[model samples]
Target chain A: MTPEQEKEKEEKGEQEEQVLVLDAMKRYRNGEIWDFEDDMAVSDGHGGGENGVLLGLDGGTTSTVCICLPMVPSFSHSQLQSLPILARAVAGCSNHNSVGEIAARETLEQVMADALSKCGSKRSSVRAVCLAVSGVNHPTDQQRILNWLRDIFPSHVKLYVRNDAVAALASGTMGRLHGCVLIAGTGTIAYGFTEDGKEARAAGAGPVLGDWGSGYGIAAQALTAVVKAHDGRGPSTRLTNSILQALGLSSAEELIGWTYADPSWARIAALVPLVVSCAEAGDEVANKILLESVQELASSVKAVVERLGLSGQDGKDAFPLVMVGGVLEANRRWDIGKEVVNCISKYFPRVLPIRPKVEPAVGAAWLAWNFFMKECYS
Target chain B: MTPEQEKEKEEKGEQEEQVLVLDAMKRYRNGEIWDFEDDMAVSDGHGGGENGVLLGLDGGTTSTVCICLPMVPSFSHSQLQSLPILARAVAGCSNHNSVGEIAARETLEQVMADALSKCGSKRSSVRAVCLAVSGVNHPTDQQRILNWLRDIFPSHVKLYVRNDAVAALASGTMGRLHGCVLIAGTGTIAYGFTEDGKEARAAGAGPVLGDWGSGYGIAAQALTAVVKAHDGRGPSTRLTNSILQALGLSSAEELIGWTYADPSWARIAALVPLVVSCAEAGDEVANKILLESVQELASSVKAVVERLGLSGQDGKDAFPLVMVGGVLEANRRWDIGKEVVNCISKYFPRVLPIRPKVEPAVGAAWLAWNFFMKECYS
Candidate 1:
């Protein structure tokens, strides 16, 4: 053989050896995971539970939740609000961006198994599954997740996958995907959908790429203001005293240490309430931060609505605007959600605001029912 | 013993055991590190080479540099610009915030040792050492590093510690501390000192705390603009095309994935050139970003100058404005450093902008000389 060919062969052999070791490890793990199924009685591929069951999962950076609901044949679409939940299981961090793909997949699978075990249902008894996960940005992400689900379920079972924002929107609209949903928790994103299946999103890129309307963003700005004030770059405000006392820090310089000690976005976001309190107490800097945040949040919703044409061409159309997350749930004297709603109303006069009565997991379960019905009955 | 007392004793025992293990490991590592010193012949805590030597170290997030200079007793302060550098050594990150305290200390110690060893000098032969490192925000940070130096060198070796910005300032002023220094690289900060030893600083807080003039900040805003334009939240610009092309991304959506794949500030900051390119090509969005960054950079310098009274009571007195870092040395048609100088000149028209002829490590060495002379001959 030529020297180059010989080298290629040697490298190929080493790669094959590595792949074999990885495959063996995976098989062992899969065997241990599926051991619980061996105890079940053998039956046809049909469901064991009455009318079977539907699985819905809402996976996020902080936690993954799987909800089990009965696929009652008699229930109509109008009764989505009354759908009874069979079981729910919770697990930690299923966002592939936060945790690696392998760990995220394992967490998702375990959560689904836990939910099924709680409801005394097997995989054959699952009729449909809808997974709404945080990291599902591209079609590739959705297809990869669908492939994983296909491996674990019978081919006859229906499956759907979407970004977690879809679940939030569905929760507010009772499974009808035709409006904009704004989520402003530790991070922020605005997602919208049309009834005919077109969808768009804005500002879910996390803190680095500038989701400035988020809880983390607002708190970070407040901290910056405190630093600016202490360093004589900006006007002094009550935030210096209030934030320092709240954190039990002696000076603004300590904030740098406190911020970088742990890079968790949620830890910094927890200071949002203090910012609100300061704004309510007439701190101009804090007030300005909140006002800017309101504008930012409104802009996100407006962007989505404008992109999806949820607002009609003339801009006078009634569309549900689902508002979720801690930043919006602030029912304070200086209500952020209220201000955002008002700001958007100037551009969209008929914008109907919604606060989801059910959690996102319930929305995912309803989505499973809806997607299954469409595929089977179309 | 009581149950609580027994529990406390057990916990204390575990803590002691852990400390002992860590201590033994540290001692072994330290022994390995200083083994070269043991091979050297013992010398008096005085001159080994002619007039001995002085060591200066500039420790930063990216890299650490140590410069060794011969101590010349006859050289006048006016001839400081021609100080001889005996040796130079380089090391990786020595910032305590980026690398842990132990690792940062080891890097600093190793670099200094390497510099001394290269020049055939010992710690005993060292006159004074000035370590100007990043992450030295508080007096406590300074004290902790000073304590580390105390353990490394003999008591007679006069040691000085300051923020890395001080070295940059001294570099432009030829070791004089009476000037303002503005550093705008991956991060940005403005530090100023008066002749009477009064000092002030502004905007040294990292990107989270709003160092908006920083390379990281400018690049992040550019990325944000791309996302906004893609999502229809902001005006479409050349940045969307320029940044995506630079990153080899197929679309703006891919930018999110590329960004979160690695959380390194410098990695993102590297995109500053692309933003600059787009702006120079007449992209309004990119132009606006640059303008805002210029204002932010100028604000920091103004804040420091005003606080330290470096511009005098009328804010028109001449003071050396030392400019350093890649952001300032753009040398392009759309020069960010030139704009910053122009902006600051409006308030202090006589602001003398100086780009340092020597690197910061050499400035640290000069600082060591000045500090040593003041202490010994005062």
Candidate 2:
């Protein structure tokens, strides 16, 4: 073999060794292996209220929140919307899959107790609770969350649970109880039910795989642009200074350390505001990133609309499209919202767009109220 | 403020907290913070060879290799080429900055001993040793490496050390080392010396900030594409399956876990081969990725060439551009080499591309030779 080929063959050996060496680094010189800590949140059950209210909890990757609403046995959808929210509470991350079971349980309990306290209600006053959590994608994941909730609340308290996407849809509909919700928080996804009760979704592949048009996606693009500019591989952008200042770092080099130091998807996603601010300041790179995100999200709406067959026919009602999450909700000034609306309108001219009338937690409570309310009317 | 603004303000609080929390995590959970271990490599002192041969060590972010070259008292530039290479050795990672210092010392010792064994060279007979290590970016980083090396070798042994990029440049030009070397391994950079000895560099920034057209850059793009395809935000490709198979993982979801599990830059960079193979197989996504990488690399070369004023003039010598690292050097069948050559030639047609005539270790030795040879001549 030529010397070049021999050199290549030898280099190949080292690449293989490099991978094996990493596996050996499984344990560090530091003997401290962190166990999943259970004391993730604080809980205080100190309040009193009237009986027969249903509680709704929205537990997500970063935080958990709960809202309490009075359940009227004979209420219409309109009355359900007008019902007063007794209390609300928020706490730390409760993504069981990502953060571990004990941590999730502790955070959920904290939020639940805080919500019940704010309502001046004892645990016994709550008639039922519905928890719509992020990361409840599979049936097994859903069951695991239900099991955790069951262990906390009294056995007699009725409970319901689903993916947080369901809460997003319910919140925007205001108990109308049908149609699609497009969420673009740190991640992005479009999910909805057709009038025929069939469900469809697009995107939502999570941080590493998908999350197009999401907060993380925007931040990632901004980072790439900044790096490219720094390398002279791409055009210049204001994202570099904005991102560094936002992170309170001094230089692009420090930004690398900060990014990899934790490398949490949510933490990176939080930088979306920095990008948005840059776009607002007329940074060409930031504007391009935002436009691309809007386009991707619009395409998601198109896919879900096609998949669920939610297009409005002649004389039929337009498909309702509820926009949620930080990216979509914050897009009014930047016109990301307007662009998405325009792009999706090309496919479904009469598609109705709605923002949530109540908090997602309150919507979850409304769904819980509807569960037994429907039974009473039947 | 609007509720959305309030939410944004509240999220701002969390982002600040996230930054602080990361700072707190700077302390490793393992209390046994590693110090540079001195005795990592076993010193057999077993081999003996003719006196006055210089030793060269090229220690990179990956494996470390060593070369031994004979030094003649009255050798000219042409005569230096005729000297036989006395020995060679290869060992695992010796990058004190990226890998811990202990791992660095251990691998260096192993390669040193193995090379000496091959050359039958005793420590007393070797005239001098030059080490060009990856991650010697700053004086402090360089001092750390020197301090570690000081502990390993006797004080009487003459020594020199610098970043591996220097060795890469020297390897291509032999002893007449002037002009830029463009590298696109797991990382990327352009470094060069003018005839008068002034030095300049471009695009050596690490993965997050720059390293344009590097293996890590291509891998990151491939990863983003795979995710986009999976989510329907982009066209479907064979990358998802190929990447999963290459990593020996089952699902795309598992990739998030695997990626962040250790998240070493080289580990991710190692996946570039998979992308190249896919591109070779006519995967459109992979081909696009390759083209972008080549373009970025070309831009880096352009920046460095312009910075150093290495552009060819009517009466001046043709500027030499050395191509180094796995991504450039391994492109026999794939044509990444041809693409880079074509791209750079567009900017300066007289630019010369030279592959390394000697291993980087041999170049390091040549540098050591030049150090004393010039001293003797002067």
Candidate 3:
């Protein structure tokens, strides 16, 4: 076709599509669209409008809750900052009694409300709200969070809530349907999906049981090493002095008092990187601890791959492995990241490391959009 | 020859050696002869005659020091119950300030007075005094302990001081120079010496760094698990409930309070075995911790062996590994011991397991006797 004719044809199609888009947009703003089948009422600019969608939510250790809507345009910087508002909105109705939980809910709600208030006219036109949060791993917990979101927004708003790990996986893979994602933040866990929709997991028992190689694990190890060194049992590492100075205590007795008195355990765990840095500086004890942690994390990943039967028997491409969380992000260019990658590569041939690009909130928003699209089309 | 002819020949030899034997026997009775020497003293008919001497002392974590001279023929139930006279002799020296240079001088005076009181008519005839102690790690400490004994006896009185670990090693090895020794009572450590005088050690870094597989480490791990479980971040192990019950604590806060209220850290460590027992009963989390402890200890032993260059192509005979300590004694016949042994053997061949047969005090005495013999020979 001539360029001029093609342009004219496209413009005519665009005009017709704009009418349908405007009508659907109005319905969305009015909170009248409840299911994916609502999309049928809108005309496809293209003769065939593909409506396949996938929903993802990331409930993170730090962020509390995040949602994603891939069908919608990515949120602007201002909108992204409004996540706290979204989080708080969902958390406000959950009836959480703990002070920490309550604080987190309030912070999330305020942040989201601020962002939505700024968006003003644009807020009502958004579709879907898929949330992923930490501690929402159980089916009941997941439903409670989803119900809270539904209660705040219009009843027609499609919502999906899942453990934050899902968002990490989606973020690491950029919403890919396959590959493993390891999240090593305050805790450690690995989740992976196969092309055939099969899923496998390892570690993720939290700081006490498994969470190996995580920040919390490293911190705990560092504290234990400090105690051992003080007692003249372990090799001296800089962490001994660093931890003592950080906690503002002298003598082992005083440090023990500080640790046991308030039991701010997570703060103690956050010192793992400092321990890692010391190890990298040739501290024998620190190195030993880091080595053990790396081995543990690698083992967890290997287990996930093995359990999923992802290893190719006939030299096929191995499944991709991506790592997410502060450790991976902070250490991506360091020896620890290299070591983790090396250890993981031993078990699988086709390991793909995707630097986390989407914040878990973005992943959650993607999920919300997918949920809305699925409801509108189905 | 007939019996008569054999008797006649023996009589003639005895007649020829009578003076020499008599002199040797006299020296033996005075504790002035070494039995391992090529030509040693023999016993005289009189009690004053020289004969073999045995000295035994039970050095404990606390200050219950016992000294047995001419080695008691048998330890009767009543005799063992009554405190040894030597214990009373050093009772005044058991205070904390009774250590170092000043305590050494005072202890020396008291020991001399006690010896004089017990000597009766044989005050000048006594030859040697052996003292066993718990912390004779340095030559100065040994000398200080010995000087106290020397002050109590004549200048000719030889003195000895050795740590409890040495005694335990000697006892466990049946006085063998080439064997492994594990000492696990209130604390734990493992040591091994070869016939060629090469030494290797593992764990024994007191209750802190290297006692990975020890009871204290187990208890610490269990306690950590309990804290994590209580905080809703760790997998719930039977150890969590069992430890709470053992400590008479109904909540985490109470447990934390009791654990850190005083210098009662050791008391909390005492609960490790309960965790182990629960682990043996199929508590997944407890079992994992135990298994990790075993792995750590085994790795320590492997490192020691590797450091000594005792493993690999160059060594002729495989190094013998010994198990000492209360934990091994309690678990040696159990799966943990078997697993440890199996794991160790994988790294080093020809591991001979032997229990200690001599107290470290005896080893110290043996060392003292050797020193005396060397001096006399020189």
Complex DockQ per candidate? 0.35, 0.16, 0.01
TM-score of 1: 0.86
* lDDT by residue (tens digit), candidate 2, A44-63: 22222234678888888777
Tens-digit per-residue lDDT, A20-137, candidate 3: 9898666544444333223433342111112212223343443343232223334342343333223222223222322355454444444443333332312233355566666664
lDDT of 2 by residue, B1-378 (tens): 855575578679999999876754442222112111222233423232234577789998668989888767567776666778888888877887668876786677667656765655555556677888887767787777678667656666667778888888878777556888988888888887888777767677666454648988888778878766654556778888999898889866567667767757788888888888889889999999999989888888887777677774542458778888889977556778779999888778888899887888888888878876665557
Candidate 1: tens digits of C-alpha lDDT, residues A22-87:
876675466445555666555532233567899889999889999988886567888978877888
The Cα local distance difference test for each model comes to 0.89, 0.75, 0.55
Instruction: Give the candidate number with the greatest TM-score.
Output: 1
Error of 3 at B285 (Å): 12
- Output the better candidate (1/3) by TM-score: 1
Candidate with better lDDT, 2 vs 3: 2
Task: List candidate 1 stretches off by more than 4 Å.
Answer: A1-50, A72-75, A97-106, A113-125, B1-50, B97-106, B116-125, B140-156
- Tell me each candidate's TM-score: 0.86, 0.78, 0.48
Docking level of model 3: incorrect
Taking every candidate in turn, the Cα RMSD to the unseen true structure, in Å, is 9.2, 14.9, 24.9
lDDT of 3 at A59: 39
